[model samples]
Target: MDNRSYFLEEQRCVKKNGSQEISAHCDEELHFDIPPTAAWGTTEVQLREDLTEERQETLEDTANAFQGRGRVVRNNTHFCALTSCPRILQNKKKGKMGVTFRNSASEGSIFIGKRTVKDGECCGVWDVAGKYSIIMGPQRKWMMFSRFIFMDRLIADSHQYLEVRYRNGKKENKRGPLSMFEDPIVHESIAVMNAVTVDAFEVIVVYSEDEHGNVKRNVVHGPTVFIPDVNQWLHVFRWHGSRGKDLHEKVPGALVFTKLRTIPDQFYYNAEGVRTADDTSLTVKVMVFFQLTNLEVMLNSTHDPIGDFINALLADLMNFGCSYSYEQFVQNAQQLSELDTFPVMCGRASAIGFTIGKVVYRGYAASTQLQNLCESAIKTRTELKLKAEEQEQRERMRDYEVRGAHGRGDAERAEELAKQEHQLAMRAAQHQESLKQAEDAHSKALRQKEQMAQVELAAKVAEEQAHLAYLQGLKDMGVDLTQYLVSKSEKQPDKVLKVVTAPSHFSALPINSVSHIGGLNIHTNV
Candidate 1:
């Protein structure tokens, strides 16, 4: 028979061996070519007898018989068996297939002719024989078969973990460096978590739930990694300030002060429209440096430490502006660097667990009019100072000139006095030498006169003795001594003339009596 255009109905009755009747459906396509000997019957006994004779025949004879009739039995089934039996399914690979029953009301359960198969229970091929129905079957019940879901092995690293949730609403944490086969019972995997790592200078604050369900906090200091428990959470710090607005908005987690090292922050404060003691308005700019000291105290005390510092510094600067005059403030501007100037800031920092390291007075600005006036005053004062300095310098120069003139005069006077003293010394030496020469000449003349006188006296004494002896011989035949003296004076006429010019009247006594004249005392009376 050619069954190419034949389609089965919802409830089709087929007669087996011309006697037995059966209601059935065929899900697969049916195409058949059968010989006259392999035709169907209306009776079950005839169907069974035909199937036994076909099985007893040789395969080539059956195929030749079908070929002679211009038809072929592809599945080797006789026409009577095709209309009475259901199809069979087989698995030849390593995976699972899902067989869902259209008539079963519960999940993973199926109903056979007289038995039931539930979940987690194994079913043999025979148990599922009539349980699977086709879409066009007598009951119109359809079975849906799912494709294979391959079993695979999962691996996790040391820093990774898996969160598994079951069909029963139970959760489990699977941490690794390990490999595990996928359990058939697990429903799904929720997430994969990696460990948080920190350096030696950092720490992490974590909040977790305890066994009693109470929330607890802890600090983790590292050079290490931190793997949080399934129920634990990390602490996030949020800070807001004028300087940090954009930074905080973009990366809020960066403000979490995990570092244990010292941190420095700067804030600028402008105290505007402040009135000085002299009623002068001023605007002062002050910069502040601050650091965090104790994290525990900070968390317990305040939410925004930078904001607190800014407010406190502004308050202190305003107070200072109100207390001092412009000049006083400028003169004592260095006082801002001292911690004592920021009492409010210091107190607030201590309360909020921060340390105020230093404050800097970034000078000040005033209204345009006030600035111009101050500049004018400064210019006038500077001009006056310059003029005074110039006059002082001129006076100094005049004094120097006068001093130089006086010094030159004194030097000239000193030189003149030195020259006069030298001349006087030379004159005194020359006078001394002349006096010595005169005294030496006088002494030599006196010595010569004395020697001449001594010689004359000796000669006179010798002559007088010789004359006496001659007189004694003249008394017995000698000449007179007076005649000898006259003869000696007559030989020297210049001596006679000197005697004549003598202060005595000895010229009148005659040459013969001139013995008493020329420094010779002869006892001759005339």
Candidate 2:
């Protein structure tokens, strides 16, 4: 447009219900670099290509590995295309914000912090505004694209035009620089454009960086919002970046961005059908990041960066009458917030004075509550485990006492048994002594009795001699001689002795009867 030329490539048709739709689009192909960090093996974007035979082959070579031009891909083949823009500074304080370089050092410990810049700030390498590009699929309707800058600057000077190019796979003129400044000056507030919606956007990425500088990526289907509305908020604003450990660490590299919502309102094509603005102060501080690396972006819903330009063309803005309102927050939000989020905005547009739907607000509230519950549950579990350990320690002390008592009882029983065993041994010795004394006494008594019996027997022998003399005298006298002689025969009528006796009667007396008849004999046995 520097040469005063005009051609419309993309336009917005405002739906009867106030939502905008892509009604008419020119058949076009524009190439933007596959950010070196491209998520889908798309290393560079082909925003605009020169239709040169040599360049075509190169394009094919670069895009050969890309699946459906990175709309989606298999496995980890998707990588976010990354481009390092030279630094530019706009800060009135500290220093300016401009492109800077870093040696891709493998060593850790090298971390860069945020560089702050203030208003009226401008710093691009002279005659070398850092070049940026994009590669995309061939589509008739223009969707939206996203960009991240290290810093921000408001466009105070007249304007700067965006150069664009496109190409088809046709080897013969298959690709070439499609157009430069396809639309007029975009994003910045030009006299002809509406305020771009550069505020309150979301960047969802589930991604991580590798030691070898590889990035794994996936695309997040973000909340749907009017693309132009997204662009207006993207206008030049301050950004802050920080590095820290996350899911992947030991050492981790991360850049989180915080942006100032600059676009301000719903984007529309302006009175000249070229620029846009709004009545609502649709702006807030929100940070955006592509948590997903290679979207395998089967469906990417990136917000428009040219919101103001698109809004200018919408008939509703003119009918609604541009009224402005700004709602400022008392505190800054560093993490993702639910207030005035995209989903909320979808159901209800919360201008400084707009009303919101109840269901949408409730959903956001529930989401926050769920996150809190998870955190609380984790904390509670940790506390309970700590308490359990304390109880276990107490139990150990109690068990120690019980074991000590059991050991003492065993020792006491052993001592008592030893005393009883000693008493039994003494009793046994006494019994043996008593038994020996009784045996000695019995032997003495037996000897005495034997001597006495012998003495008595001697006396009896003398008496028997005397009796024999008397018997002889009687025989000589011939008085009853026959009676005396018969006595001899009667002396021994055989007496039977009893040999068997009961054990209890072993020492009982035995008796023999004498026969007093003609030839009987009598004797007593003890």
Q: Pick the candidate with the highest lDDT.
A: 1
**Model 1 error, position 199 (Å):** 4.1
Per-residue lDDT, model 2, residue 49, is: 23
lDDT of each residue in 1-526, candidate 1, tens digit only: 2321122221232324435334343222222333335444221111122222112111112222232223333466433233321111112222222343222111232221112232332222212343322122122122223111112345568987766677787777778776543433454544566667777767678888988999988878777877777688787666543345432122222344433434566666666766777888887777778887787888789877766776777788778867888889778778878899889989999998889888888777899998998999999999999999999999999999999999999999999999999999999999999999999999999999999999999999999999778777766655566686677667433222223354465556653233444555354333
Best by TM-score: 1
Candidate 2: which stretches are off by over 4 Å? 1-410, 413-417, 424-433, 436-526
- lDDT over C-alpha atoms for residue 476 of model 1: 65
Estimated TM-score for each candidate:
0.40, 0.16
